[model samples]
Target: MDDLFARQDVIKRLLNESRRWAFVGLGDNPEREVHTQARLLQRRGKTIVPVHPSAATVLGEKGYAALADVPGQIDVVGVYRRAEHAGAVVDEAIAAGAGAVWLPLDVIDEAAARRAQEAGLDVVMNRCPAVEWALRR
Candidate 1:
């Protein structure tokens, strides 16, 4: 893991500043961590946009089939896919012009992280938004 992955300042800024988050792979499954985290973010006053192939609305937010399909600016792109599939999602996030890309705990992709960083997006890999927010409080 890159040292930047664990930077407290970066985590704090991402959690405290970003308002809109696009959750890729966020399906309608309540049991999934993505669903739980998205709900947590919503409770924190952040807008959550669901991005999935099914495009099924989750948590009452409209869903887009792809990141590019989203109509407005996205502050963060939260990736919930497996590590193997995370790189592609990061690429999409970069292309979508997100302010940051977050790969939750257990999802590690250093190469993709570098790519996102190189594209000027804050990269937070192997971290959980809920946990980060809890620590700040």
Candidate 2:
């Protein structure tokens, strides 16, 4: 799992280079970890696009109802959903032509991760963006 899901090089590349991050499951709820993580990355100069059913603005960025609804290029789709729901989000990310899919800490979907990799998208699973960014910094 370390070699596949926790690849340091991939994590560094995504966190270092990806500018646009579409966070799935991020909504108006600030109490959620997704909100906090998005805020953290946003503070670091990354563009955060909230994607949820409500499509409510989060972190001052416009939100999209779904990955397909997001326009332009999406560098990374952060799957903040639960493990069971993560696979579908990863597939959606692939369909949306995202450059990468990041399933934050505790969200593990090996099959989905492999599928994303097969689709030529960098996959980071079972890892926290904030932690990775801090360690790398």
Candidate 3:
């Protein structure tokens, strides 16, 4: 396993400090793992920004069609797409100038992560935010 994707300190800091998270692929469907993860963070007082094609409000948070569409400073961009699509989201996050790019479990894009890191964004890939958050406690 590549340690590049498992930065314990990065995960802890993001989970503890970042307040706004743009969850890509998060939609109205509550069944999706992204929704659940976003909700878990939302319940912890973090603001959730849903970035989905639907652009529908999710978990009481406004939705945007893309990362570029989200207004204000986005602390973290949660990548919930399939591995193949994660790179695009990461690139978008970098372009959006987000503080960090978080690729949840099963989503791994080393090239994207490297690009985001090179862009000065904190990265945590192939890790579940909910699990990491819980592990912190």
Off by over 4 Å in 3: none
lDDT agreement with native, every candidate = 0.93, 0.93, 0.92
Candidate 3, 1-137: lDDT as tens digits: 59887878888899999999999999999999998999999999999999999999998888999999999999999999999999999999999999999998888889999999999999998888888877878
Model 1 residue 26 CA deviation in Å: 0.8
TM-score of each: 0.97, 0.97, 0.97
Off by over 4 Å in 1: none
Clashes of each: 0, 0, 0
lDDT of 3 at 5: 72
Model 2 misplacement above 4 A: none
RMSD score of candidate 3 (Å): 0.8
Candidate 1: Cα lDDT at 104: 95
Lowest-sum lDDT 10-residue window in model 1: 1-10
The per-prediction CA RMSD against the true structure, in angstroms, equals 0.8, 0.8, 0.8
